[model samples]
Target chain A: MSKQEQLQQLLGELKAALPELKEIIVASSDGLPVAQLGESEIATRLAAMAATAHGLGKRIATTTHLGNLVEIVIRGDQAYFIAYAIGDKGILGLTTPAGSNLGLVRLEAQEYARKLAGIL
Target chain B: MEPLKIVITGPVGAGKSTLIRTLSETEVVDTDAIATEAIGKPTTTVALDHGTLRLDGHLLHLFGTPGQERFDFMWEILAEGALGILLMVRADRPETLPVARNILDFIKSRAPVPYVVGVTHLDQPKVWQPEEVALFLGTPLEHTQGLDPRRPEEAVRPLVRLLELIGTNA
Candidate 1:
């Protein structure tokens, strides 16, 4: 299948697995939206922010010798914004309700991020 | 020495990163990533570029912001605590002036700091001069000047001008 189709399918699978997610965006490492589920209006800005967060996270990790960065999580009053690096080329971001099970979400999202790395 | 924070901002491909890299005394901390859009370059600054310089015995901390509007959130974040701003624009690409003006207005509204406009790419033929860019931007001609971002001597002129402005206002 085409790369775009593959990306959509991967996002679809992730969405199905985590219905609690309020937003999902798959963006290129350069801060461009590839595929997104939920709020289309915010996908572009959020995608850029995802790349920015990933870039900063990597720098912080290297500076502190924290090993490779796994994910970046921002806790808000009503929701959680979490971004995971998909190999070297892309990132997977998810917005979840504040009270959701973050531990389980991280496990599933990290696996999906690895799969996304393979596809992209 | 207390560092004087200076912010360099403009539209895409305006040489904001290059100017900071050129003026910095130490290695620059840049967050550049691959470009997915047609921005005339393969890479773009996603977050900010940070560098330091000791100009005339005064320590200067330089921060460069991403050009794309999608990253407008960063403009304010970097502009905060900044003592001056150097807004760069490409003389070759007149189309970006509107965006440049918007950015200037946005930052000025928030930071209200002294700012100077640096018109880059004047080395190229058929490009706007500093005076024209200043006219179009509605800024004082004295507050705008042309410079080559790749050269340290030329790139530092606008920053020096900004420092002068900040000092005069203070």
Candidate 2:
């Protein structure tokens, strides 16, 4: 299968595992949404937010003398957004309801990210 | 008591927050929290995140800087009072070396603090060896170690050694 098809299959697998997951987006490291699952509106907003967050992460790394931007988790009243970098140019983002098992979500997302990185 | 300020910085997905969370279990204050408060918003830690831990009666203040370069102003403030820096590099992508160098230059220009590089994501085969990375970055061989930023034990030793090195230098 083509890499894009493989990534789509993986996303399908993830969605199947966690039906509560509202959206899964493959975004550029800069936060532009490359591929998304779910409503267009939600994907658009998340893409922008992810890009902004990624940009902010890079700025922080440079100033603080740390190293790199890894992942970011933001908790909201109704939902939560977690963005994880896939290599340098891609991010794996998941939007789930509040109180979701973040540990599980992170693990799944990370696994998918690894697979996506291989294809991307 | 004075806090031993330490700053954690790295590129996107390099595991800075995970590193800070692990370090918080050690004896240091969370500087990233302080930076968050300073920004007055949940996502606006434009400068730093603060945490603290008490180790051997010493209160270590930990500062986590934002990973983006545009928010550079915060680095100056966070770098103040820092005894040393723990530079976290992603082993998966050596391209981050330039970003690491940029941060190192900023820190060197602002302070004479000793630094130790922690190479994260060693579990991934794409990551480079610590020795090769050290040579690539021109950092001393003794100052770099392979680490898993997700695990506290793996992340903290290099930082502790950095503190010890700073103490010896002083």
Candidate 3:
């Protein structure tokens, strides 16, 4: 499959796995939007925010000798934003309702992130 | 004139963010995270900064890019359709001049827009004057000005001159 199709399929699988998955975005490490299953504008903003969150998380982890960053989660009043590191070169941004199944979301995210990272 | 987008760029500690913070009429939107390295400063800009001002009956949008090369991927993205470039350089730190020139070259090689050099930190003792900076950057003396970036009045001086230069300097 083409790279774009592969990314769309990856996001689609994640959405299918979790009925509560509100949005999913895959972006390069440099904040370029690769593929997204959300509004175009949010994808652009998500690309930058996810990259920054991943960089900050990685920096903090490396500094504190915590190994490497796996996930960075920001829980707000109404929603939860997750920035998951895709190996060392990309970020996967996901959002969901505040009380959604965090465990299942992370599980599905981890699997798809690895696959997406390899394809990227 | 319609809304004009101007790119603000320089090396680390060269006052690119400070200039925007001081001159922007609205609250500047910035994406500065903790520095991963020892750069004398605790935080560094990762994504572009956003600010706007109305000058000479025209809205001027200021976009500031990070100085670190690791974040250099943002340079082109933030520079899209920029009418002019305002290259800020720290007069106190001579080491940053080359990187400042590289940023200029990178953007100019792509857009070839008119630009003016803003030599900052002039209030500090023993710094390069505008003429010498103009000589070093290889731009004409008229296209360079020294200012204290901490002051909004002084910070906007070079940009006003840049807008004027776009009429002739480009």
**Which candidate number maximizes TM-score?**
1
Candidate 1 contains a number of clashing pairs equal to 0
**Whole-model Cα lDDT of every candidate shown, in order:** 0.91, 0.73, 0.82
Q: What is the lDDT of residue B8 in candidate 1?
A: 94
lDDT rank order: 1, 3, 2
Q: Which of 1 and 3 is ahead in lDDT?
A: 1
lDDT score at residue A15, model 3, on the 0-100 scale = 88
The order of the candidates by DockQ, greatest first, is 1, 3, 2
Write the residue-wise lDDT of candidate 1 on B1-170 in tens digits: 77899999999999999998888889888888878788899888889999999987679999999998888999989989889999999999999999999998988888999999999888888999999999999999999989889999989998888888988988
Give the winner by lDDT.
1
Give the 10-residue window scoring lowest on summed lDDT in candidate 1 chain B: B28-37
Error of 1 at B48 (Å): 0.7
| Model 1 ranges off by over 4 Å | none
